[model samples]
Target: MNLSDRQSKLLFGGLVVGLTAVGVYLTVAAPDDEPERSKPRSVVTTGPTAPVAPPPGIATPVSPDSFDVYRLLPFSQQEFATAADLAQRFTAAYGTFRFDEEPRAYADRLAGMVTEQLGGELQRSAAAPGLQEERRAQQIVATGTATLDRVRDIENNSIIFLVTGKQQVTKAGKRSDDSKQYAVTVARDGGSLKVYAFEPADAGQEGDTG
Candidate 1:
């Protein structure tokens, strides 16, 4: 049987509405294209930093016991050793004069050594009449104590020492003594040690040079 024109038009309208509803439902149920929201990102930072280092050309400090003025001469150990040997020789010469019976001979020998080691000024000073009398009476004894006080590398090579004690003297069967503090400066002279200066600090006239 053939349908009427109005009924056929109504059927076509209903089919179009059903298709629209099915398209909407499929769009809502489809899976998403983007990744999962719970996953962590994979990013990297810059490379590790380098370590710090000390500067160059810095010198380490020296010990105090290693300081010696004579050692400073020529700035070498060999030169200082030579100066030390010479200092010992001078000590021997002065010691002989200090304990000799013939004071004049002792004075002559000491004057020669002083002139050679210290110069003409010291020689003249040793020859003074008053000084000669003191020598004859054995009023002084040239003695020293060598010690290494401190060694510092910050300031040019430097050393500190203390020479303290007394000199014994005998006059007319009576003995007397004197106490003095002496600081001796040392330097190297042509592979030998020479005393540059003797600074007297605390000097007290007690009695003798013994």
Candidate 2:
């Protein structure tokens, strides 16, 4: 409709105020966007989600087996085996003797396996005139065999074995077996194993020939 400028301006201003009131009322009355429907509330999980039932009559292991006590010892497995072998050989050498072998050679075979002090004793015992003469007259030829009975004791760097030394003697075409038990000590000697000391099982006094 044709109207004056002042009337038109008044009408435009009233329209603007009415629209602003309506916008504010609509904004306050409208609810939120339904909180996005909570997205069905999915959760992620991993690894052994449930307690697994073991098989019937099977026991659950308390824990994995640990290391052996022997592994904690100071010596290596090879060293221990070497020491044991040395002990057995030493006992065998102690009783084995050839009829034609010299006293020095016989003693040397055993002396080399023993400590210096023990070796000296063995050398003296082997070189005895009377013992050598008797052996020669009897024509004795002995072959020795050894077996370990038990471990008598253990030290930091040594082990004592209860050994039975068996000797098969042939004299004048007659054969006989002789067995004796001794406590044999094997110890470390300058990066090698040697017979430290040995005695009869009863620890009795030994003759000069021991």
Candidate 3:
């Protein structure tokens, strides 16, 4: 069920309704939830040069071999920092789910980072009793490590992060772990970059530990 990059893009038009959890132990995820969104933070880079957004009508170039969309294109430093910061915040918020916390509370925490469609998905899947029951019975807890694997511009105002991370699931006294890669898509909403889709790279594929 691994979705190719083309298929992933199709989801932008509301083509997909549910997404697999990838390596996450919780499979029940996808419900509608909304929380107040915070304003996007301003980007400040080193040096006295003030960064400004690119003007309209200019096409941002793409790199076929790398994720550095701004590498050859003329882009302000602020854009780089903004994309990086957004990716960091989304990863932090996404990887912090706890079994002991209430699902609604968790959804609230992520409301600002995700789009409404994604929020609903999160609430539904997180609130599932089956997932809760399994976690409770196994004393399972999960943690994730997100790394910026690559970055590329999607549309003029959006960026996609090729993120690599490790998900560690501890059940009872034993732990099982796997490393996974995901493409987290973000688009500019007002002044903030909001996540619209969270899809794993090579979806439906599993990693092997050596």
Give the candidates in order of lDDT, highest first.
Answer: 2, 3, 1
lDDT of each: 0.50, 0.84, 0.72
Runs in model 3 deviating more than 4 A are: 1-75, 204-210
Query: Which scores better on lDDT, 1 or 3?
Result: 3
How does model 2 fare in lDDT?
Answer: 0.84
Question: What are the C-alpha RMSDs, in order, of all predicted structures?
Answer: 15.0, 19.3, 39.7
TM-score of structure candidate 2: 0.63
Q: Give the alpha carbon lDDT tens digit for every residue of 108-198 in model 3.
A: 9889888888999998888899988887788777776778877745567677888776778788879888677778887777766688788
TM-score of every prediction relative to native: 0.40, 0.63, 0.57
- Better model by lDDT: candidate 2 vs candidate 3: 2
Relative to the unseen true structure, what is the C-alpha lDDT of residue 16 in candidate 1, on a scale of 0 to 100? 97
- CA deviation > 4 Å runs, candidate 2: 1-66, 205-210
Candidate 1 per-residue lDDT, tens place, 123-204, comes to: 5555677867866675444543232222222113322223443545455456666555444455534444455544453334
Q: Top TM-score: which candidate number? A: 2
TM-score, cand. 3 vs. native: 0.57
lDDT of residue 172 for candidate 2:
72
